[model samples]
Target chain A: MYRYDEFDHAFVSARVEQFKDQVERRLAGELTEEQFRPLRLMNGVYLQLHAYMLRVAIPYGTLSGRQMHKLAHIARRYDRGYGHFTTRQNIQYNWPALSDMPAVLDELASVEMHALQTSGNCIRNVTADHFAGAAADEAADPRPYAEILRQWSSMHPEFSYLPRKFKIAVTGADRDRAAIQVHDIGLHLKKNEAGELGFAVYIGGGQGRTPMVAKKIRDFLPIEDLLTYTTAIVRVYNLNGRRDNKYKARIKILVHETGTEEITRQVETEWQAIKDTDLKMPQQDVDAIDNYFRMPNLPQRPEGWSQLAAARKADASFARWVDQNVTPHKNPDYGVVTISLKPIGGIPGDATDAQMDLVADIAEKFSNDEIRVSHEQNLVLPHVAIADLRIVYDLLLTDGLATANAGLITDIIACPGLDYCALANARSIPVAQRISERFGKPERQADIGELKIKISGCINACGHHHVGHIGILGVEKKGEELYQISLGGSGDEICTIGDITGRGFSSEEIVDAVETIVDRYLLVRTDKEENFLATYRRLGAAPFKDALYNETANAA
Target chain B: MSVKVLTANRLTDGEAVWLGANGDWLDHIDGALVARHAEAVAALEEAGKAAIKSNLVIDVNVIDVEERGTNLYPLRLRERIRQLGPTIRLDLGKQAEKTSANAA
Candidate 1:
């Protein structure tokens, strides 16, 4: 994990002090709500439906044991006894008192964590694949570059107040776990024919009222030019992005309106002016960052294989968890263990303070004290010994974290819908919960195969519902809460927005509708290996649409 | 024909609060002052002034409510959810506390 230096410490502490003063002034009635709203928002404070929500950035989803413990402490001491890990790999405390926000931030700063740039129309927290360093297929760890971007984008004077909130996702792996194709600026760290590091840039992708897959602006951008290239992109966006309408203010809108060819021309023009200036990253600095992210001296444990195999053979459920939750690591002895936050019939992404502390303890013990928060709303022990997998599973099971539902139907991504959000038109968690319960059977989930069900309570698509294989969007019609089902949305290398199959269903009917769609997928699939997205793509929406609307209606 | 009540999240703690008949902000939705037509507008104005003077809440607005027997209920599902905790987790937030308290 990256440690904060003196400059980073000073910058965060000063920011906390500034926000402290702002909160004090607002509480003392010196600053009115109109005056305080933006200031509070800049510090990641949002006035939600029931409480002031404090969103703390978990930079690149990397966490130390100490930092994780502090988060648990904050959840217990300052706000509600739990926190929600969002799709952006950040944790949100749903019930923090406005008066106590400064203190909360102070606690965050102590652990090199902060709420800065987690929100607002600025570069939000840069997200990466949770298994950054450990993933077997990765050419490089993306965290260092993400950290570099975080430093550059933190309070960037020019881009602070942009056309709209900008999001950047970086991934070093080929499978694109970071969902790079759905970001405003997606950087894929790759190598040239000479084995020189560079980025494959995808720009203009976003999910909201209007969802679009990003188009590639640059197939190969030299790694040394990361900063200059990014600056050029933002500068072009700042100059040309829409500001007249908030709805059409994102860079995706600009890319859609201006056409990729024109935008590329503008970015290139801007890049020519500033590519070789002070903005260019020195090769030495890049090497130093690479050194910081050097693979730890994990002594080779060849015995782990036999030990793990023995344990798997001993316990059937442990074997199942190993199959589902444990991902292959670059090291044969090590495995990336995904700790599922989605307990069966429980709220997705929610971790109570006790559960968080337990995870921290486990991370400290077995994962080299390093934890990663996945964008899918789960925690990851990025490097756990294969031999220690069973022990970790047992510990996680005690805290309800070992659901063995990674990539399973129960592992649903849901936004804080009408439950806590001020803008949500419908409740997302209840629908997710009902679906989870309906398909809670392990045998059924395994039979159904890999399915992604994403739910967003509103059109903002915070849940990335647009990219779900089975997307559920909540909308209000005729004073009733209804859910619209969309099929075949994906956020992987092949990015596509789900198509609305039919009319909306009432909250009571949405889960059954989802089951119907999944059941149809299971029936019509070429093989068990054919996942929901592939099956949907092959058959198109006609079959799923028939199952959802026509057959359901006929049955009704 | 819509009965309404003024509500806001308290500025200090961001808890949901309702404008009471005695011009005080109460945590409970049942204590909210119900009004019709002109009274609703005046109540909202009063709520705004209270919000400014006390710095008690932010985003003050009127929500439609209806009388269901002796108790008043918010008409829209959004407002109803705001008044209660998340419908999914019945054991959490203020709704659970309220339920346990009522049971006691």
Candidate 2:
């Protein structure tokens, strides 16, 4: 976790006070609702249907036990006794008071956190892989660059009032966990042919009304030119991005309109002017950041005689857990343990106050107290010793955090839809719960195998449905809630946007429709190893659509 | 059914407090300052202006304690700015002219 220095501390503290005054003015009628809207939004406050919602930034989804405890406290005292962790790794209090927001912000600043760019048309809280430093194949930690980008973009005078919101993602592993391909600017850290470290830049990827996978603007950019080039891209977007339609204000639209080649040329032209300037990273800065992410002292893998009695008789439960919850860690004995926030039939990405406390305690005891919130709505103990897995799992089980469904069909990603969000056309959480229940059986989920099911209440893509192997988008039909399914999208090493399968289904019919698709995959897949995505890719939406909609269509 | 409390940053001490519970909103406080023991208890009493409450929230509600706003001491900076009237509170001639133009 990055501690706030005086400069960072001072600015956030001052900004909180400024917002307090703004709130008072709005309350006292000194400022109109219109006048206070932007000011409040800048501070990550929004007026929803029922009450004010305060979005507090988690800063790349990294949190100390102390910070998590503080969030738990806020949930208990200020809002309802809980908080909602969002897709962007931020936490949102669905119901906060307009007047109390300043005080909330002040509390956030006290912990060196703020809601600064959680919302607004400006750059958002920069996101990276939840497993940034602790992943097995990491070439380097990407947080340092993310933090640097955060500082540079915090309130940059030029980019503050952009045409629309800008998002940037960075990754340093062979496998892209950061979903770098779907961001406005994606930086993949790689070793060039000459063995020099540099970035492969992709610009114009975004999700909205117009979804796009960013095109490669630069094949190789030296690390020193990272910020300079990023700035150039933003400058280009600001200069030429269409502000006429809110739907198409993203950089992706710009790239699509003026061809990626033209945008690349413009970015190159802009970069030529600033690449050698102050934006370049100092060697010391990079070294300093890299130092924070060095590998932990890990024990060597045991020289198993291939028959230590078949590994102590293989804990069947442990195998299931290891298969799902545990990810590849750099060290043989260490693994990236995903603390499942989704219990069977439970809402996605939600942790109770007690569960949070338990997680904090576990982090302190076995995992060094460093916890991360994933964009997929799961908490991760990025570096957990293999021997300590059972204990962590047992503790998690007691807290309803131990559902052995990490990437399985039951591990869903859903946004707070009509249940909480004023912007949603339908409720997303209940639908997710229904589907999870239908596929809640461990055997059923295991049989289904490696699936990404994402549900979004609206087109904002908060649930990241556009990138799910199976995407469910809930919309309103007349006054009823309807869901549309898309398939073949992914947010991993090889990213692709999902294509819509067919017509929408009603709220009640949606779950059955989803089950229909899952069953189709089970029947048609080459083997269990082939995921829903692979199957969808091998045989396009035609087959899955035919299976899911044929009967209902025939009836119609 | 969930309720979210809206706290404010008190100018006096730069901390957070429940509006009516921690302090009072004076309809007619013409005297000195008084201290209250428990803010949670005081909030139940007639304290300050309220915005909204008692609504639909199905998901888990988070109150990140780290975000409890600064240590509110309650000095009301807005009222102070208004009462002082920006270095020209006693200028009755200008006020009269401004008031008269409005009347006209």
iRMSD values, candidates in order: 1.0, 20.3
Model 2, backbone clash pairs (residues 3+ apart or across chains), number = 29
lDDT of 2 by residue, A114-200 (tens): 899988889889998899888878777788888888989998999999999999988888799889889999988888888888888
Q: Candidate 2 overall Cα lDDT vs. reference?
A: 0.75
TM-score of 1: 0.98
Q: Tens digits of per-residue lDDT for model 1 on B1-104? A: 56888888888888888888888888888877888778667867776776767787788888889888767788898788778867766776679889999999
Q: What's the fnat for candidate 1, on a 0 to 1 scale?
A: 0.89
Compose the digit string of candidate 1's lDDT tens values, residues A445-548: 99997999999999999998999999999999988989998889999888899999879999888888888888888889999999998898898999887887
* Chain A fold similarity by TM-score, each prediction: 0.99, 0.95
Task: State which candidate has the highest DockQ.
Answer: 1
Native interface contacts kept by each candidate, as a fraction = 0.89, 0.00
Candidate 1 CAPRI grade: high
Model 1, stretches more than 4 Å misplaced?
A552-556
